[model samples]
Target: MQILIAGASGFLGRRLVSHLRDAGHDVTPLVRRPPRPGEVRWDPTSGVLDATVVAAADAVINLAGAGVADKRWTSQYKQVLLDSRVDTTRTIARAIAAAPDKPRVLLNSSAVGYYGDTGDHAVDETAPAGEGFLADVCKVWEAATGPAEDAGTRVVLLRTGFPLDKDGGLLKPLYLQFRLFAGGPMGSGRQYLPWISLPDWLDAVGFLLERDVSGPVNLTGPEPVTNAEFSAALGRVLHRPSLLPVPGFALRAAVGEFGGEALASQRVLPGVLVREGFTFAHQTVEEALQQAVSSITQ
Candidate 1:
């Protein structure tokens, strides 16, 4: 299988590329800068991608987008978040549609944020979308992949959860606080955090690529932990005591509207993937935290 991956330099993207390559798949990364050894340059912002790159690929996994939680959600940054996802997806969809030999599968990236604050509700692919800025962005983002689907390609939208890795994503900030012995629960500490370990996330992506699955599939761990449980698990794995608690008001004041989403409850499960017999490499929060923290320290 020849796979072309956008955002191949990002945290998850880098890992995904390596995983695909290790599986004996011919991997070509779509980078923004000059072509590195195995990378191919394609500027999604300007909609300038190499035709040769898209034409020769069996699948195109679109992960190109600005970081949603990278900055404080100022009004401008909010627009940047929405436009980055929608525009990049649209660009890739158009390019895929125009390609002579279109890729068989279009694995577009999405988030669990599409379900918004589902308090204790088990959301499957059949669940209707929730409402919010991120939800709206995801709705449009997924819809943007229509071009590829219309072009007779199977489109798989991965509604990813909080990918657990010590070096990046949500874990980085938590690790800093934990190193200082100040890491604890956030807000009420009751919000259900649907999370996935990096290895499991990569495996899920590979499973989707190899299978005949399409539409929105929740790429998350089967065991959903609350914010407090997650913090305690991380603290236990690091052999550190979690003492500090971040108040809801502080987060709200610091991040504005976006903070609410972070604090809200969402107990999501990967029903579709599990039903389809996808086995998780790391099933529990404790096992995931141990591996993630150990990897960083080593």
Candidate 2:
């Protein structure tokens, strides 16, 4: 299969590209820069994508978006978050719609934050969306793919959870603090972290690429751990004691509304993926942490 991936240089995108290539699929990276040895340039920002580039793809995975937790959610940053997602998705959808031979699948990205603070309730793909900034962003983010879906493309919205990669993402900040022996649970430590190992995340994408699955699929580990549990698990894996607990006020002062969302309870599960026969490489938090830490150290 010929696969075209947008944002191919990003954290998940890079992994997805490697996964697709390793699986014997011809992978093409769509970027803003000129086409390199194996990459194809497509400016989603200015809506200047070459139709022939995407029209030739058997599948197109859209992962182009600004990081939600990259910056504090000021009004300016909020707009960045919204536009980066909605606009890029819109651009891709339009390109796919205009393509002569549309891709069979369009796996667009979303987040488990779609369920907003679900407390202890385990949310599946069928769960109704919750309220707040991240949720609102995800709602529009998923909706922006309608053009391609309407054009007969099988659009799948991957409502991703926290991807547990030791080299990057959420682990970066924690790893530093843990190495300094100042890492522990954030806020009340009760907020559930619905996280996925990078391997399982890539595997889930491959599974969807090969299957007829569409709509929202939660790309999360089967086991959802609390912030406290996550802290302790990482600490255990790193052979360190997680003792420094961050207070809610301090987090709010640092990250504002987004910080509150992070600290809020969200016990999301990968119900749909499991029920659909998708097996996980790391089912337990400890196992996932071990793999992530091993990758980081080695």
Candidate 3:
């Protein structure tokens, strides 16, 4: 299949591009700069995208969004987060709508933060949108794909969780902290942390690309563990002691409003993926951490 992906330079995106290419799919990346070979130039900020480019792809995936945890939640950066996602999604969706021959599907990125702090309650794709800044951002972010959906495209809102790998995502820094003996749960350590192994995350994306599914799909593991459980799993995998814990107030002081959210509980479940018969390579956090740690050592 011919796939065109925005945000192809990002950590997950870079891996996805390679994964798809290795699987014999022709993947073209949408770049901000001038077009290179096998690349399409698009500027979401300027709303510049060729409809022909959109029409030619068999599928389109838009993972373009500002990192929610990259900066403190100041009003300015908050707007930046909102605009970065909404604008890019709107541009891609509009392009797809304008195309004479539309792509079969659009897998747009979202986050499990859509459910806000779920406490211990589990949530699937059918859950209502929750409150808080990250939740609000995810709401608008997913809604930005309206144009393409209105144009009859099969839109899949990827409500992703923490994709754990040794190189990037949530595990990298945590790995370092563990090695230094500073790693432990944040806040009360009771908040649930929804996670998926990196390999599983990549494979799930491929599964969604071909599956006859639409709407919000939780790209998370089958069994979600609490932050404390996550810390224990990582510690066990690394032969480190998981004793020190970061207090909630200290987290809030360090990263502003996002700090509270860092410890938010989201026991998200992959309802669609499971019902569709997608299998996970790592069913538990410990197994996931083992793979991630092994990758780092090698």
* Cα RMSD, each candidate: 1.4, 1.2, 0.8
Measured by TM-score, how close is model 2 to the native structure? Answer: 0.97
Model 1 TM-score relative to the real fold: 0.96
lDDT per residue as tens, model 2, 1-298: 9998887889889888888888999998887866789888877778877778889999999898898788888999999999988888998999999999898999999998899989888788889999899899999999999999999999999999888887678887788899888989998898899988888999999999988888999999998999999999999988889989999999999888887888878788887788889989999988988888896677
Best by TM-score: 3
In model 2, where do residues sit more than 4 Å from their true spots? Answer: none
Global lDDT of each candidate:
0.88, 0.89, 0.94
How many residue-pair clashes does candidate 2 contain? Answer: 0
lDDT of 3 by residue, 1-298 (tens): 9999998999899999999999999999999998899898889998888999899999999999888888899999999999999999999999999999999999999999999989999999999999999899999989989999999999999999999988888998899999999999999999999999989999999999999999999999999999999999999999899999999999999999999889899999999999999999999999988988895767
Q: Per-prediction TM-score, please?
A: 0.96, 0.97, 0.99
lDDT, candidate 3, at 201: 92
- lDDT by residue (tens digit), candidate 1, 48-91: 77666787999999887889878888889989998888888888
